[model samples]
Target: MAVQPSRPLRLFADYLRLERVNLTERWMKAVFNDADLSESDRLTHEQLSDHVPEILGEIFSALEDQDLDEVEPSIERNARQHGRLRWKQGYRIDELVRELDLLRQVLMGAIDSFAQGHPTFTRRHEERARHFVDEAISFVTLTSIREVVTERDRKIDEYTGQLERANHELLLKQKLVGELYESRMQITRSVVHDLRNFLNVFAMALQMIARAPARTNAALALANRQAADMKTLVDELVEYSIVLGDNNPLATEAFDLRVLFDELVASCGPAIEAKGLRLVHRFDPQLRTITTNRLKLKQVALNLLTNAAKYTKVGEVELDMRAHGDAHWRLRVSDTGVGICAEDQQRVFREFERANQDDVPGAGLGLAIVSELCRKLHGELRFASHEGEGTTFEITFPLRLDPGG
Candidate 1:
């Protein structure tokens, strides 16, 4: 293998860098000083600024020329310019001289040797110089554009994710607060009804005792009646508190409708009697083997029935249950009460809502609890009513009883 001369090559590359600098300096100086000179001087300055670089580059073809003697005049003219106008000032022109010398040395006798017909080293040196300048410009442009694009994409991604997170947090807070307000309203309505019922029963008992002829009978009856009324109110309040727990766990079980209906009717008699309304319940005993949380379902049923009794005036309140299939049943409660207005129907399920025509006393969660309970049992509920006529709530509960049993 032939060994390469590395030191000669390094000097050769430096030579090209200085050559371009010298050419650039001459071109700028000629443009500034000779822009308005006389026509002949203008021609001379244009050759120095532009035409000379082209003539010198002709060395590659000059090497192929059979007569290299004719190119001598141009080279000698360039050499003379380097000594006179090109190398005039000590401070300003010294830079041009240094550049010219550096360029001449890095040429490394290539042009001279090529002119002397040494073609082996010429093409290689030309390629090396062109590649260095091209690559340097390309690398700088690519680096700057890449940095700008990368930064823009990063900021866009961060902003999109930030907005999504903010919206998610807002929805979560809205849901939590709504659940809280619902629980408080349910508790308030339950307390109000229980309190009123207790007071009414107490008043009835006191009046009966006050009319008694004997002191002994009046005192004994008063104490007993008051105790029973207090007990009933306490029981109802406890059940309401259990259902009103925001995170309460309820038990589902199988129960007969005949037994459940009788208990509900007897338990709610005081509240119904106080409102001067009659209560009616209709359920199918054969299809009543339903699997549900008996206490919770009972609470739901009683609340609906009681609300009907409280709202309706001079009309009968009815609770009716029917078997749809082995898989589900429909429980419909209709009242001859003040019907819910169409505009207020949607808002009736909202917490703390009371209609403008709603003359009854109850917080607005009776239907909301019914809706939630229906969801827990995999059921569906709907209602229809006419204004001032009556309202009918229809619920379809899945039959959770063992189908194959």
Candidate 2:
């Protein structure tokens, strides 16, 4: 004979199908009425009622088929939906878990009501009801926690990306501010040093005129020339300040390189003679007139030649101009003087930085100004030196020629 179905199993299946709607209503009312579930209660009735009926239908099918697989997918999906909803709605995880606990209580209460109304009810029926409800609750709770963890990790990654971008922007701003500060300090030091030199010359001219009234005309001429030089220095300083804005215009012209070299040598001859050092110059035969900023180039040559004369005592200071290539020329100023030490070489191109030799009368702005001017002219300046031997500065610039000149 075939065995009959168990009474408790049949009764449980009948209870799930017939009482599913009523049980869901009771659970919703309990959650909304509870003071501890204010966040869930804030949602509309339709939103709060979402997925509850489907979950009940899955449980009912599982009971009828005697297979938990019938309800597994529904349980996992409902848990994830609830986890995401509560997160968006500002509900705590513990509060959502509490609502699940209330669902179990409502289901068990309905089972007890069915037992109280039926005459054939038994303890076995209660145990089977508890088993199904407990299993469903455990699966949902675990899945919900997993979804919450995923959402939290995603938020953390977004926050980290935002912080990294902010840090990068802050570092760029700091670098730009530091560069501006250094530029301003360099300009101030150069102005002060150059003005002091011009003022000294002016003062000496006035003293000579007062001491020798017979030569007043000659002294007055010297003072007038010194004043003109001061004016030129002021104009140069203004040009440099505007260069920092990257808008200063270059005054280019065609000038004979040989003539410029001769003028420079003659201008500095007296200083070289006074220091008892020889001045030597050599030029490549192919070198000729070129088009460039003549005044700026002259300033560069004058500064280099003056520095060479100030340092050298006995040996010669040599100036050489040669054709570097088809498109370039190199100017070299080499001096047999007290050479720069290794530690001082690194800072020699910085404004107001001098070598260890303090006896040399200089404000330490010559090489620094040369470096800046080279950059403005789109050229390169390099040097080699050894203590007690010599120093040589070489600059290479593009050979831009004028057809008209």
Candidate 3:
């Protein structure tokens, strides 16, 4: 009650099964090695040769069964594998489609050659062969396209994920930059307020000195000290502003470290005297001349000295410097001050954070500014402290700095 495949269809199916290896070799030779095919030449024999023989065998089996369903699963699996491999190898869709077309052509051509050589080849057998080839091509083409689309969608998803991550990182950087700008503005406002107060005091001291002839010497000395204090405050504000600008605040030059040390010691003399704290210093002989940002380094030293003088009540504040090697130097500023508590130490270097010491006359920008300057100069800042006993801040500086900076 069932119609069977014609004589040639059965013969052709048997031939395909027996000649699959030969057909695969011919396909590789004709298509994969073709110079006209871009990127195909880059693939090895194993890469180009995979799944071809299996595809041929599946088509032959479908012909033997005289049913397309027998081969459909194999076609889908092979097509998917082929599409993924081609995509990973950077093959274009057009090139892969062309390769599939060539595969069909080579397979039919091999079958046609066998039919031509056989004596029992009839018109009915040829028709059956053409039908089998057409059905195989149709199924393979549809499956190949489906696989290509799936792979393309996968790639799009992967690229979209990467773009999203990059966008997230950019947003975080923008937020950090905005916070830094706001902090700088706040520091400027605080500095301006202090400047106004100092200027008023300087003006009043000047007027007193001018009016009082009996106490002229003492008045003049007071006026001179106030003027110096005002100058120092102005200098600090200017340094901070420069550091925030486009150009590098560090000006590298050969200078005597001892001279800078002496200047800082003298500048802190009034504060040290007022606090009743002894100031002691030691400098390494090798710390004479070097290439660095002199003003920025001096600023760092002054901040450390001022902090020590501000906090220390009775014992001594010591400044020591030593050559770590030919390439670097180390400086330590230790004070017998009300040392920072463990919990407060972490917050001390952040802008407007005063380590729970609200009694100290500062907007909490001193150490924060110092920390920033240290970063710009490619330096390291570290500290050791025990509450109510003492604290020591250490800094290390490189000899040769970043030229591109």
**lDDT per prediction?**
0.57, 0.77, 0.78
What is the Å distance of residue 157 in model 3 from its true position?
A: 8.4
Across 42-141, the per-residue lDDT of candidate 1 in tens digits comes to: 3344444543353334332232232234454554444444333332222123333333333333343443443245344456654543343233223322
Ranking by lDDT: 3, 2, 1
Candidate with more favorable, higher lDDT: 1 or 3: 3
* lDDT (10s digit) by residue, model 2, range 1-405: 122436666677787788888888888898998889888767887777677777777766665555676569877898788777777777777887888889879878877887787767677756766677777777777787778777877888998898899899889989978976886677687667667877887888788888988888988887887677667656545554444455556667878889988888889877887888888989888999777887778778887888787677779898889999898889899999888999888888775566666456555667767887777666689999998888999999878833233
Best by lDDT: 3
| Stretches > 4 Å off in candidate 1 | 1-162, 171-240, 246-250, 254-290, 322-329, 350-372, 375-379, 400-405
* For every candidate, C-alpha RMSD to the true structure in Å: 19.3, 9.6, 8.2
User: After TM-score superposition, what is the CA distance of residue 87 in candidate 2 from its true location, in Å?
Assistant: 1.4
Residues forming the 10-long window of minimal summed lDDT in candidate 3: 354-363
TM-score of each: 0.44, 0.54, 0.58
Answer with 1 or 2, whichever has the higher TM-score: 2
Q: Over all chains combined, what TM-score does candidate 2 have?
A: 0.54
